[model samples]
Target: MTTFVTLTAYGLADGAVLALAALGFVLIYKATAVINFAQGEFLLVGAYTFYSSFVIFGLPVTVSVLNGVAIAVILGVAVERFVLRPLIGRSPISVIMVTIGLSAILTAIMQLIFGTEARAMPPVLPRGSIEILGATLPVQRLLVVVVAAVVLTAFTLFFRYSRHGVAMRAVADDQQAALTMGISVRRVFAMAWALAAVSALIAGVLLADITAVDPHIATFGLLVFPVVILGGLDSVPGTIVGGLTIGLIKMYTFGYLDPGLADVIPYIVLVLILLVRPYGLFGETRIERV
Candidate 1:
């Protein structure tokens, strides 16, 4: 029972963060029909930015967080406007390669600026412990779950009623039809990228809290690929379900089996799902005729 409680706590925390990361991936894919291989790099930048502003530069927590988020939003908008907008009608492969290259550039820049060492942030959350099922666990874990739930709920509401959210949803459904209705497709594209960055920024902060501000945080973004793919790349709700499932599987496997297997398991599940449903479990199947 103790082991189960511990594993469940860790799993839920990890899963919540993964859902945030995968949510960004799905937003960009759904809105623009482009895969962002640089998603991890965005998280990398966010973590480093926050560490620098809050710890190294000795800024207030609120300002530091806002600065990090601002940078993320700018990066996303810049990428959409300058790097990707020009390639509007290019092949998907071309866009994919561009993002891959962008990832390399972002990684190199982060390493050059921050170096490869891990930096610890001053603990922002209380380090108190709580009992669950006769097992004592860090209260921080529960707090993270609560934070994730609140953020996810806010996003859900934003999409359902907000004007910009409605525009984005329309664009995702059909760009041409949205344009016909006087929606600015370009603006929608930019907003999607901006929102993606915001989600990545939040995920990076959560990861920095769980782990640390380090290059490995970026690697966590890569792991989210499995979560997004498994849940269905274009499905936002899929992110939540898939993230929790993968998180539990990884944590329990690590506690009970080989540690290395935990990392491998999500990918294995993704492959099995892909074999059975190429468009993903919740992804829409489009029949494009030549």
Candidate 2:
């Protein structure tokens, strides 16, 4: 029972990271109708930025985080302006291909700059453990969970109440209509990318704390796909729930099931979910006019 409790708690921590990363992917998709294949590259950039700030520049932890986020936001906006905007209104396939190409480019660039070797990220939070219900969990894991909750809450409120958020949503729903209504669809697209970058930075930081910072960390971003699909591509709340579900499944599979089963559980769940509800649990159903 204690083992189960421990696994559950740790699973929640893992889910928190997955949710943040997936949220970024969903945000861009919701606003721009573009699936950013480069989303993982942005996470890698953030992890590297944070590492540089702390280890090379000798900056404080908070400053390192801020620098990482700032760099990611700038990179996101720049990519939107230079790469995405030019290809706007093109075929979705074209856009997806461009993003995939960009991902390769970014990965190459990171390798040139940071090398392929993994680097350790300085601990952002104090190292400690606390016992809860006879299960021990690292304080850092708890911090990750807390931070994820705060970010999700803030994002929800921003979208629900803020003017900029409303504009972004309007654009997402109907870019042509938004433009007709004087909302700068282009600007909204940029904002969506920027916000997604911010989320990536947070996820990168949490992941770096748990695992070493490296090019491979970008793979974690790909894991977000299951969460995004399960939660519904357009549903923010669904991301949270979906992330938790994936995390729990991972834990249970690793614990009770065969170790190899852990690797395939998320994909299995994703397939089953799509089979039942193609649009996802919280995703909106589209009706074709034709």
TM-scores, each model vs. reference: 0.97, 0.96
Q: Kindly list the per-residue Cα lDDT of model 1 for residues 64-106, writing each as its tens digit.
A: 8899889888999999999999999999999999999999999
- Model 2 misplaced stretches (Cα beyond 4 Å): none
Give candidates' CA RMSD values in order.
Answer: 1.2, 1.2
Q: CA lDDT of 16 in candidate 2?
A: 91
Task: Count clashes in each candidate, considering only residues at least 3 apart in sequence or on different chains.
Answer: 0, 0
Q: What's model 2's overall lDDT?
A: 0.88
Among the numbered candidates, top lDDT falls to: 1
Candidate 2: worst 10 consecutive residues by lDDT? 118-127
